[model samples]
Target: MIAWMMLAQAALLGLLGAGVTVAGIAKVRMNDWILGAAAIATLTLVVQIVASIIAPFTGSGPTGDPFEYWVYLVMAVLIPPAVALWALIDKGRWGVVALGVALMSVGVMVYRMHQIWFVQVF
Candidate 1:
């Protein structure tokens, strides 16, 4: 895993979480800005997933268990879209909270992914 890429993902994901949470607290619902942020974060995550998959073939991979890494990545890719859909359907403050939680989960998962990539076993 590239250091810069890992950091960028974490930062962007963190921003996504913060943005969604703030929107929730303010009782805002679906909007172009919210959708755009989610799109960017989701696109980045999909790109990262592809990169990780190819990394192994390119003689690069996580030091930790591959199965665990892939499972997390796949779930991360799925979550944002799911929550976004739910937000669109609900169209309320609770939907915003759900989006915030989903984005935060993605942020935490991305951090864990970086840890998995760089683990040092004795």
Candidate 2:
């Protein structure tokens, strides 16, 4: 995985989490803005998947186990949509908070994946 792209993905997710958290604190229900942000985050993960596929060919392959990195990537890709679905179903302020929390979790996951790809030893 490319360092810049990984950092961008984490930053995007962090911002998305903060925005959703603020909306939740204001007691706003799930709305287009939240859903749209989630969609955008999900799409970025898709882009990350594509980047991962191409990165090794360009000589930026993982320093750690490829299987582990891929598992993290696949799981990270699922989070935003899952949280979006949760928000849709719940239609409550807490659901928005949950979405925010999930986004933050995915951000952490992305960082972990970055470590697995480029920073890990042994």
Candidate 3:
């Protein structure tokens, strides 16, 4: 990932994380605002697809096994939509918690993917 991509990913993680955490803590139902977050996350995943395709040429690509990075990528791509779908199916505080968990999980996954991408450097 490049600098902008990293920053964007971090922003998404923070957005999703904070949004979910607050909603979960406040016991709010799944709402349109959060669905907007999911849409942006989907857009991010689209960016990820483009980034992965070009990363190797830029020499900013993963230095370790690309597979590891890809696995995290898959999860990162899946998370928001999956959580939204699940929350829709099971609505409650638990649903909000599920969103929170998913967002937090994305944070961890992104960090791990960063490690996987740069492992050979450090």
Whole-model lDDT values for every prediction? 0.84, 0.89, 0.77
**lDDT at position 25, candidate 1:** 84
**Model 1 residue 33 distance off true place after TM-score fit, in angstroms:** 1.2
RMSD of 1: 1.6
Q: Better model by TM-score, 2 or 3?
A: 2
Q: Tens-digit lDDT track for model 2 on 1-122? A: 77888888899899899899899989999999999889988998999999999989998788888999899989989888988898999999999999998888888999889888885543
User: All candidates: CA RMSD in angstroms?
Assistant: 1.6, 1.7, 1.8
Top candidate when judged by lDDT against the true structure: 2
User: What is the TM-score (0 to 1) of candidate 1?
Assistant: 0.92
- Sort all candidates by lDDT, best to worst: 2, 1, 3
Q: Taking the tens digit of each residue's C-alpha lDDT, what string does model 3 give over 1-122? A: 76457556866776787878788779888788766777777677768768887988977777879987898888788988888898888878778778777776776677677777778686
Tally clashing residue pairs in candidate 2: 0
Which candidate would rank higher by lDDT, 1 or 2? 2
**TM-score of each model, in listed order:** 0.92, 0.94, 0.86
TM-score leader: 2
